[model samples]
Target chain A: MDIRRLRYFVAVAEARSVGKAAERLRMAQPPLSVQIRKLESEIGAPLFRRGTRGMDLTEAGQALLARASEALALAADGIEAARAVAAGSRGRLSVGYMFVLANAMLPRLIPELRRSIPGVDLDFAELSASTREARLLDRSVTVALCMPAIHHPEIQVARIGAQPFMLAMPIRSPFARLGSVPMARLQGRPLIALPPPERDPSSSAVAALLRRHQIVMPIASRVETVHSAMSLVLAGEGFGILPACARLGAPRGIVFRPLRDATDSIDIAVCWRRDSHSPLIRTFLKCAEKAVAPL
Target chain B: MDIRRLRYFVAVAEARSVGKAAERLRMAQPPLSVQIRKLESEIGAPLFRRGTRGMDLTEAGQALLARASEALALAADGIEAARAVAAGSRGRLSVGYMFVLANAMLPRLIPELRRSIPGVDLDFAELSASTREARLLDRSVTVALCMPAIHHPEIQVARIGAQPFMLAMPIRSPFARLGSVPMARLQGRPLIALPPPERDPSSSAVAALLRRHQIVMPIASRVETVHSAMSLVLAGEGFGILPACARLGAPRGIVFRPLRDATDSIDIAVCWRRDSHSPLIRTFLKCAEKAVAPL
Candidate 1:
C-alpha cells in the first residue's frame, strides 16, 4: 500500500517467514505480523498462509508481490535518477562485464566514466553474454560491456570492437611451432573449452563454431572462471580458443594465434536500455563509443 | 569507514554533486563534504576529484564504488536475514519474477507456497532474469520463479515444470482453420518471436527451434510483450511462439498448437543462492519443491 509497507512486504515475501521478515526489517514479530495483516486487510485479501512447517503466499499475496517489486525498483530507480539529476554528474550505474574481458576493458572505461560522470557511482557485476542481455532489458544496469549485438528489443547495442578468436596453445606445442594448425587438422583433436555447464560466452561460441565444422563435440574441461581456464592452457592442459582481447593480461607460456578462417571472430558491444533516461548513462555510452571507435 | 559514511559516499558517487547528495541524504552540504573527506582520509586516498563540471572518482574511488555496493547489499541482506529468523512462520519473502510469467504463474504458485510454508508474507517484483540472478547471488531474494537452469556458479536451480512452448496463430490465418498446422510447414513461414537478444532460455529455445526448421528469421513485426504480441496475432498479425502454460486470457479468436517435437519446451525453475545460510530460505526451498513437484 505504502512504500514502507511495500518494503516490509518485500522483506517478508523474500524471507518467506514472518519472524524472519520481522528480524530483517529490524522490528518485532508481532508488529510485523500486524502490519502484514493490515496490508492484507487494506487489500481485502489474504497475503499469506502459515502452518507448523513454514509460510507461503496466498493468491492475493502473489499478485501484490509483483506490483510491490516493480514499485520498489522504480522507487529505487526514481531516487537514484533524482539524485543523479541533482548532482549534475553523479549517479549509481549498475555495470555488467564478462569476466574474460573485465581486465582488458574495464581498466580503460572505468577511469573515463569516473572522470566524465564524476558523481556517478557504479555498481559492478560480472555476467556472461546471456545474462548481460537479460540485464540490459531489465534496466538492472545503466550500461553493459559485453559481446557485440545480442539483439534484444529492449536494449540498444553499440559496437565496441571486434576481436578475432585465437587458439591459445602452449608455447612449445606442435601447433605453435607450425604458426597455426589448419582448422581441418585440428578436427577430432582433444581441445579444452569451458564446458556449457559453466555458461561462458566463449564456450558457447566455441561450441557453435565446432558444430558448424561438423564436429559432434570436443573433449571439454570445466573451469569455473576465465582466469582458471587460461591458467590451465598455460599449464598445457589443452588448447583454448580465447578472444584476442581477453589475452591482454595473458599469463606466461601461452601464445595466441589467428584461425585460418577469420570467421571465428567475436565483436564486443556496449549495451544499455533503449529507454534509459539517465544523462550520466547517456554520457558514458558516448564515452564508451569513442574509447573503442578506432579499434 | 562507517556504514553511514559509505552510504554518503554512495550517494555522492551517484549524485556526483555534493549539494544533491546532501539533499538526498537530508543533511547540509558542508557536513556531507566533510564526511566524504573524512572517509577519504581514513581510506588514505582522495576518493573524488572536485571540478567545475562535477565530482569524479579517482582510481581509489572507482575501487571503493564496487566494494561499497557489495557492502551495502550485504548490510541490507544482514537485516533481512535477522528478520527472517525472528518472524518464524509469519514473515515476508521478497519474490522476483520475469515480467510476463509473473502474471500467469505467480497467481497459482503464491498460494501453493503459502499453503506449504504458512504464515508467510509475499512481496513481489517483476525482475529481469539477470537482476534476479544478481540479487539471488547477493541474497537480496530468498527465492525466485524464473526460467530454469541458469548457469551461475553461485546460484542453485530447481526445475519446477516444463512451460510448453506453443505456436499462436492469428484468427484470420489459413492455419487457424485447421486448429493446428503441420509444425514443419509453419517452419520458414514469417514468424514473430520475443526478441531474445538476451540469450534468454525462452528466446533461445524459440530461435533454436526456428533454426532447426531452417525457418527464415521471422519478420519481427515488433518487439512487444507477450500479451500484446498475442493480441496482435489475434488481430491477424504474424504467428508467435508462447509458453503453453502462460495465461494469455485471450479471446477465442486465437489458436495454439503444441510443437511437433515434444522436446521443444521452456522450463520453469525456482532459483536461490546456493551459499545462503538462512534457515528460512532452506525451509522455503523445501516447501516450494513439494508444491511444484507434481507440475
Candidate 2:
C-alpha cells in the first residue's frame, strides 16, 4: 500500500475509532472511513473490526503497523542523505594537483576544507603533464590544480593564484650570484625540459614561454617530473625554468631566481569539467581560492 | 525526496537527456523538464548541466543516483511484505490448544499449514481453563484448538469435530469388560473432574454434562490438566471422562469406554477473537477444518 493509506490505518488502529482517528488526522470521519475501506479492499484483508464500543485491529493491521513506520523512517533518511550531498556538506572529492601545487597549496587547503565540509572524503591524485587533462575529462578526478592551466572547450578553470617564472640552477652557477636573469641572457643556455602537457605535446610550457619572449633555449635534458628536472639542475647538466612556487620544495644546493625581462607567469588554477555540477567540486574550488590566491 | 522525484532523476540520469527520458517515461518533455528542475531546486544543487547536446549528471547528482534507487526499492519491498502478510501467505501464528486436542490435532494441522503457508512461523501455547479467555482477548494467542469449546461474547468459534464423552478407567477395573456403559450406571461413581473453563467456574464440563442428564456423580478428585486427570484415573482416585482424542496419548493401563445413553459430547473447535480480521487466522482455521473435521 502507499504511504498515505498506511498513515490512515495506523491512526485508526491507535485511536480504536474512525471518529477519533479523523479528529487526530484533522479530517472528517466519512472520508477516513472510506480510505480505510479502500485500503482493506486493496490489501484483500480486513484491517479492523467495527464494534459497538469502537474498533479493534485485525492481525493484518498489526503486521502492517510496525513495518509502515519503518518504511516512512527510511524514506525520510533517503531525502536527508540526498540533501546533505547536494548542499556540499558531504561527499567524496578527488583532487588532481601538480606536485609543485601540492607542496605549497595542500597544507593551507586541507584545513580550510575540514572546517567547511567535514563530511567530505579527500582523494589526492598527483598529476603529471600527460594525465592532467585526461583525469578531469574522464572524471577520475573531479577537480585539478594545474600550472599554465589547461585550456579546453569542455574544461573550466579558476585562476586561484599566479607566479612569475623562475630559474632553478646549481648554487655554484655564475647566474646564481647575479640574482635575477633576463630572458635574453638564457637564449643560448642549455635547459632542462619537462614532458609536454596533455593538451599540447609539441613543446613544454617553458619552451612556449621562451618562444613568446623571442628567446630560443636549447633542450639539454627531458624528464618526467619536476623532481627529476631539479636533479638535473643540481648536477649542473642544465638549468630548469619553473613556476615560482617550485622554490618551496627545491633540492638542496639549487637556487631559484626570477626571470626579469618578461612578466610571463603560470597560473595556479583549479580546473574541472565545464558540465560538472557537483556541489563538492564548487565547494573545493572556493577553498582552493582562499588557500593560494591573493586577498 | 519522494520516490517519484527519485524515479524521474534516475530516468534522466540514465537517458542523459530530458527529451529522451520523457519519451521513455511516456510523458511530455516540458513537464518532465519541469519536474527535474523542481527536484534540483529543492535539493539546492544543480543535478545536471543543460548543454546544447544533452544533460550530464553533476557530482551531487551522481551521489544521489545510487541511494535514490535503493530508497525506491526499499519502499517497494515494504509494500510487498505487507501484502504477503495480509494475503495470509507469510507471518507468525500463535496457536493455543487444550492438551487433549493438541495430542490429536497438531499432527494433522501443522503439515497442512506448512503446505499452505510455508512462511508462517508456528507458536503453540497449551491452554488451561483459567487463561483461555484472557489469552484470546489479550492477543497472546491468535487462534485456539479447544474441547468443550469456549463460549464468550467476543470469541468466535467453529466446531471442526466432536466426540461423545467416553469413560477412562483402569484396565483391571470391573467395568473394563463392557463395550459401553449406561449413564445411569455412572451415577454415584467417583469422578475426576478438570478445573472449570475460564467462563464458568461453578462446574466442570463433565459435571455440567452429568447435570444435563439429571444424573449425579460423586467428585472424588480435581486436577489441573488432562495428563493429571489421567494420572489420577491410573491411580484409582476416580474414573475420568475425556474426549476420544485423549486416548491417543493415554497411559497404557487405562481403557476408554463409550458412555451409552448419552448424546452429550465435547466439540473440537477453532476459536478466535470476534474482532480479529487476520487473514492468517482465517487461513489457519480452514486448515484446522481439513485436519480434524469429517467432510
Candidate 3:
C-alpha cells in the first residue's frame, strides 16, 4: 500500500472509531471509512470489526497495523536520508590528511562535522602531500588536508591556515632551556630531515629556510612523517624542524622551540579534484573552513 | 534539486552532449538544455562550457555532477528498500524459537529466506513455547517457532511440521545400543521428563502417550527444555523422550532412537499475534513453510 493509505489506516486503528479518526486526520468520516474499506478489500481481510462500544481490530487488522507502521517509518527514513544527502549533510566522506595537520584540525573538525551532519560517515587516512594529490586525482579520497603546493592541473586548493616552523629537541637538551633557538646555534648539529623535497612540501620549505639562513646543519636521519621524526628525537637521535601544528601532541620527552631567524611557515590547505563535485566533499570543505577559521 | 533533474544531469554528464543525452533520455535536446540551464542557475554556477569539439564541464559542473549522481543513487536505494519492505523482502525479522527446532528448521529456512529476501535482517533468540507466546503478544518478537500449544486468544498458530517421539539416551546406555526402544522396557525406570504438561505441549503429549501405552516411568527430574533434558541424559541421569527434531544437532555424547510404542508426535508451528500483518512475518512464515515442506 502507498504511504497515504498506511497513514489513514494508522489513524483509524489508533482512534478505533471512524468519526474520531477522521476528526484527528482533518478529513470527513465517510471518505476515511471508504479508504479503510478499500484497504481491507485490497488485502482481502477485514481490518476492523464494529462492536457495541465502537470498533476493534480483527486478527488480520493487528497484523496490518504492525507492518504498516514499520513500512511507513522505513519509507520516511529513506526520504530523509536522500534529502540530507542532496543537502550535502549525509553520505560518506573519505578524507586524506597529513599526520601533523590532523592532530591540529581533526580534534575540532571531526566533532563539529558529526554535530552538523550526523548522517554523514567520515573516513580518514594518513597521507603525505604528494600521496594526497595522487589520491585526489584518482578520486580515492574525497578531500585532503596538506601543504598548499598542489601543482596538478585538475586539483583545486584552498588555503586554510599557516603555521611557522619550530625546532623539536629532547626535553633535557641544552637548547630546551632557551625560549627560542637561533639559526646560528643549530650549526653543525645533527638534524632530522623529512623525506625528499619532491614528496613533501613541508620538509622542502624547511630546507629552503635553512639554506636562506646559510646554516650548514648535518642531516642525521630522514623520515617519512613528523611522528617518526618525533620518535627519533625521543631516542636522542637528532633535533627535528616541524610545523607549529606538529607541537599539538608532541611526546613527553620532546620540546618545541621557535627558530629565532625563521620567517617561513608551512601553508596548510584543503585540496580536491577540480573535476569532482560531491555534496559530502563540499560539506567537508565547509566544515574544514569553519574549523580553521577559529585557529 | 529533485531526482528527475539529477537523472537528467547524470545522463548529460555521461554523454557529454545535450543531443546524445536527449536521445538516451528519449526527450528533445532543447528541453534538456533548458533543464540543465535551470539547474546551473539554481546552483548559481556555470555547469558547462560550449566548445568546438563538445561541451566540457566547468569546475562547478564537475562538483554538481558528482553530488547529483550520489544523491540520485541514495534516493533510488531508499525507494528500493521501501518497496522491498512492502514485498516482505526487506526489514528486520526477530524470531523467537526453541533451541531444538531452530537446529532442524533454521539451517534450511534461514538460507532460503536470505535468498528470497536478501534485504531482510534476521535475528534469532532461543525461547520456550510459553515465552514465545509472551514475546509475540508484547511485540518483542516478530514471530516464533515453537510447539503448537499456544492457547493465547490473540496469537495465531500455523503448524509447520511434526516430529514423532524419539528416545534420547547416553552413548554408554544399553538403550542406545538398541535400534528402537519399547515403552514397556523403560517401565519403572528413572525418566528425565520435560516440565509439567501446562507450559510445554511436547511434554504433555509424551505424558499422554505414556498413559496410552500403560508405561509407569518414574520421573527423575522436570526440566524446561529438551536441551536441558539432553544434558541430564548425557550425564546418565535417565533416558529422555524428545521430539525427533531435537536429534538433528544432538551432541557427540548422545544418541537418538525411535520409540517403539509411541505414535504421537510433537507438532511444531510458527506463531505471531493474531492481528499482526507484517511483511516480515509473512515472509518468515512462507520461508518456514518451504523449509518444512521438504522434511
Over the true interface residues, superposed, what is the Cα RMSD of model 2? 2.8
lDDT of each: 0.68, 0.82, 0.77
Better of 2 and 3 by TM-score: 2
TM-score (chain B only), all candidates: 0.60, 0.90, 0.70
Please give each candidate's TM-score. 0.34, 0.81, 0.45
Please list the residue runs of candidate 3 whose C-alpha ends up more than 4 Å from where it truly belongs after superposition: A1-295, B15-20, B28-34, B50-55, B84-97, B102-125, B134-144, B148-156, B167-191, B196-203, B211-220, B234-239, B245-260, B272-295
- The interface RMSD value for candidate 1 stands at 12.7
Error of 1 at A194 (Å): 3.7
Worst 10 residues of 1 chain B by lDDT: B78-87
Cα lDDT tens digits, model 1, B188-245, are 5666656563545444777777777666645757554666778777777688787875
Report the C-alpha lDDT of model 3 over B102-176, residue by residue, as the tens digit.
777888888988887786777888888447767887777878887645667898888888888899999988888
Q: Which 10-residue span in candidate 2 chain A carries the lowest summed lDDT?
A: A70-79
Best by lDDT: 2
User: For model 2, how does the per-residue alpha-carbon lDDT over A129-229 read when each residue is reduced to its tens digit?
Assistant: 77888899898998998886888899999888888789999999999988688788897899898877655655556767888888877889889888889
Q: Indicate whether candidate 1 or candidate 2 has the larger DockQ.
A: 2
State residue B22's C-alpha deviation in candidate 3, in Å. 3.7
Please name the candidate that would achieve the greatest TM-score relative to the true structure.
2
* Candidate 2 C-alpha lDDT tens digits along B64-160: 7766666556556655666777777777889998888776778888899889889888898999866888999998999988887888999999888
